[model samples]
Target: MSSLDILIFIAYGLVILLVGNFLHRSKEKENSSSNYFFASNSLPWYLIGTSIIAANISAEQFIGMSGSGYAIGLGIATYEWIAALILIVVAKYFLPILIKNEIYTMPQFMAYRYDNRIKTILAVFWIALFVLVNITSILYLGALTIKILLDIPLIWAIVGLAVFTLLYSVFNGLKAIASTDIIQVFFLVSGGLMTTYLALNATSDGNGIIEGFKIIANEAPEKLHMIIKSSDPNFTYLPGWRAIFGGIWIAGIYYFGANQYIIQKALGAKNLREAQRGMAFAGFLKVLIPLIVVVPGIAAFVLDAKIDTPDGAYPWLLNTFIPSGFKGFIFAALIAAIVSSLSAIINSTSTIFTMDIYKNFFHKTASEKQLVKTGRLSGVLAMIIAASVAPLLGRVEQAFQFIQEFTGMLSPGITAIFILGLFWKKTTSNAAFFGIIISLPASIFLKFVFPAMPFLDKMLCAFLFTSFFMVVWSLLEGRMKTYPKAINVDKRMFKTDRVFNMVSIGIFIMLLALYIVFW
Candidate 1:
């Protein structure tokens, strides 16, 4: 890369920090708990939609998912495509109840739906998951890219990314994160597409992107399959139809519906309709993500990239294919994805600890000022702790698959407790609590007992197991009586306007065509 590229990257970083700090200063005049955490419910549909994709892309998709694409072929894109459909289901059904009840956090919803004990338990669980698994994995993956681009040690790369995130997060909260995320998504999408161009163009030996596509299709037909066969070596990872109708749903629903960082943007929307429309908007963008992330990996594979591991595919593409002048814009794009996502999670973790843990148990009488202060301090502390632990993640076969499958161990249990508890009137707090407790052990036991079982299959079985226990316990408590806290519902609450419905239908058709073409 040229010196000009380095200056471009540096200038971009300064711009982002300046934007965040400017927002921070402007926001301080009206600082309040709702203002800091939820952007004072002022987010419009566009910001909500863009910010969701910005936060969702990050190192996990860029580094980790592309690694899976390199190793497992384009089939890994099922994660992105399936999420488009699930986002609709979540918006139409889940968001109505959450928005109506004025839910600030996922744990608050658990408290309203079941009991405070459930709230507290899950609050602690979420705080741990966000810090240990979610935050650290992202930090590790982002560090890999930084190390490649800057030619720095891995530990220093990790520390630099953490500091980049904290510069915006501790002071600005969701307002800064959300506003700046619009710019982040722009870079994420544009830069990702640029990388895709480099990959495909290089794959064609400079023929063209279309020629590159044709070459990939002719040479790697097996890689293009949407469904993995039992005979395929990667079948255990994907498991054919199981990816469509089985445990993947458990992961998708829980992630799009219950994950605090993803859902927090929607929670801060101008209104319920805005959030639903925003989700629908995000679904459309989801369809395009594969071209940016997965296609580049497939291109790497087709071009015979000699990467050391699957996760090395993206960085290898950047180094080998990127032209001298474009490196700065591309680096800025990658940094935008990493920092934007890290900031979103750090802000959400601070929200959970402050509202669900600190305010609820540690200082019940704390004022809004104190709560806001705690949110900032907690953001910094979480960043420090996650940065410290990130370097320990070492190497993985595929960080994206590892995250989804291992996290599946917990997702089914959570999906059961939340989804069932939302709709099933007789669900008891005891059953919900029991479901949460039993999820991990059941998943581990299943893995050991059926060592060859596809993780997708294992996830389905575990979900059914935990759901059965929840149902049985609830029914035994009393078959006919609805829990007092059960959410009251009417059909109108689930209804969407014509525009949203049309968008949903369009997304479904788009997904159908994709599977049909690729199947």
Candidate 2:
């Protein structure tokens, strides 16, 4: 990179910090526990929407999923496109009940529906998953990307990203994080698209994206397919028949519905309507993600990118195609994705620890100010732990798939717990707890026992098996009666307005067309 590129990069850092600080100062209730964690229920649909995408699309998608695209083709896009439809389902069904119940965290919902034991246990589980898998891998991947792009040491890159996240995000809380996401999304998408355009354009020898895409179609058509056959080596990553009616549903619902880190964006909404609308907006954004993140990887493949590993596909594109001055803007976008996601994870981790563990267990009489302070401190600690562990992770091929599979380990029981706890009145606390404890073992058992089973199918099988156990346990405990603490959800609560319905239908149709064309 030239001196000009270095200057541009420095400028972006200053602007982001200034914008974040400005947003933090603008908030009157910044110190309130609710504001710190849930944005004081003051976020509009757009902020919630952009922030959700920003938090979700980090180095994982940019580097890992892009690499998956290079190797596996458009089939890898199911994770993004399927999420669009899942966001609709979550907005209509999950958010309504969660918002109505004033759910501060997913664990809090577990407690509200079942018992304090469920809440505390789930909270501990979430904190571990976020810190260990989510935060650590993100740091590892982002640092790895920085190492490749900027020629930096991986350890310093991880620490630098963590510190940058804490500087702007950990202190100001969700409000600032979500607010700054507007800028982050701009950089994230635009930078991502810039990479895509650069790769595609370069592939066609500077013709254009459309011309390059046509060339790609003529050259590597197999990369355009959305479905993989059993004979395909990558089929295990995205099993054959992976769709809404498949195991993708289980993963999608768990991610968009029960996941604390993602849902915390909607939980911070001004109202239920705003949250629902926000998810709809996020669904629309989800459709664009594979275009920005995945297409570039395919472009790299068509161009015969020289890289040692698949995950290096994106970074290789940057180092090869992106010129000097523009490097800063594109790298800034990468940082935007990394920092936004890291901050969201840290904040959510802090929220779970502060509300579910600290406030509930450590100090029942903790003041609001104290709660906020604890949250920030926990956020700092989580960053430290995640950064420390991130370096220990060795080379990961298809890090995106690794994350999904690991996260899916916990999803089966958690999904069953939330699904039954929401829709079924007979689901007792013990049944849910049983589901949680058996979740990891069930997935692990299936993994080794049925070694050939695809991870997604394994998730579905585990989820169904776990759900069966929960049902039997609940029914036997209830003696054909509803649990006492059953959630009192009305059918009307799931109803959506015309706009949200339109958004859902639009997303469904778009996904349908994409799958059909790409399939």
Candidate 3:
């Protein structure tokens, strides 16, 4: 890499540290859980939106997604597009209630909805998912990609990232982490766009987008097609349109709307309106992500440069397409994306552990200071665990798919309970409890024992079955029980601030037009 590139990367890191330090000062001086965990509900919509996106999309998209795209085609974009529509739902429905309830963590929302048992169960599951599946897997892939491109050891890279992420999150908490995420989001998007543009330009032909697509299309047809059924027997073959539309759609909604690490930014918003605006803004951004993440994958496939490995496409693009001077900047941005996601995971896990687990179980009367301290301590502990486990992520096939499949076992059921509980007051605590418990074991069995069932489709089935059980059980058991009054989620909770809302809607429309163009 050029000296200019190295300088730019160092400069980027300095800027992130400066912003993180600035945010650290702006945060409430008092070490309180409210500020540490929720950023004192002071985050504006834009900051929250950027932080949410930064934390949600990491090397998973940069490496796994690009790799999948290189391997699968534009079809891999189903994750982002489906999530865009889902975010709209989240903005309109979920954000309002979640903010109105004023819960610190998602599991806290569960406690309010059902009983403590359900809350504790969901919280524990989320912590496991965040630490072992989400954070560790993403870090593993991110570090591995960096190692491949830079000729470094994967273990050293993982440790370095873990140390940096833990350092800021441990002291500055979500406020510092989320604040840095705003800057990280910009770098991630810019670097992604640069890679896409350069990859398209680096083809044997010229730099026109359409011409590039055409050349690739004629050159490599397999990478462009979106049809890959389980019967295909090819190991790298992806889910088809049915899986995309049905399975991915449901999973996206659950993830963007309900997952702790993703939604914590929304939950930390200044108010319900800000939270809705933030989510809608994120929805808009989600629409644009596929352009940067998925299209490049398709580009590589069309180019057919003998880079057969999917995971290598991203690093390959950087080495081949990006200029030496700017490569450092792109690598720094990639690292920022990785660290931001790690911070988000660490902070959220700590929040859940301290609030939902510790406070609920052992220290019901814990002070905000005590809670914050515990959160920071937990953040340190969780980081160590996530870093240690990161190496194991290599064991999983299609790291992203593995994360989804296992998390899918729980997400659908949890989503059902939350959807029913939030809007439908008729859902009894018993129903919520039973719906979640039954879904996990059943989903695990179906997913492992019967892999041929189009895994996501099976998850949908499990969701439906468990939901049906909840409804049936509630009716049978709750008929005689006094019906609780309907929840009074205020309309203001769903409304967005006009400025952010207008800009967000405009972006969403633009994304829709692009989706249609690509489709």
Off by over 4 Å in 1: 25-30, 395-406
Clashing pairs in 1: none
Cα displacement (angstroms), candidate 2, residue 244, comes to: 4.1
Rank by lDDT (best first): 2, 1, 3
Model 1, span 248-285: residue lDDT tens: 88889888899999999999999999999999999999
RMSD of 2: 1.9
Stretches of candidate 2 off by over 4 Å are 26-28, 395-406
- Please give the CA lDDT of all the candidate structures: 0.88, 0.89, 0.77
Q: TM-scores, in order shown?
A: 0.97, 0.97, 0.91
lDDT of 2 by residue, 86-156 (tens): 89889998888888888879988988999988888778888998998899989988898888767889999
**Total clashing pairs for each candidate:** 0, 0, 0
lDDT of 2 at 349: 97
Weakest 10 consecutive residues of candidate 1 by summed lDDT: 395-404
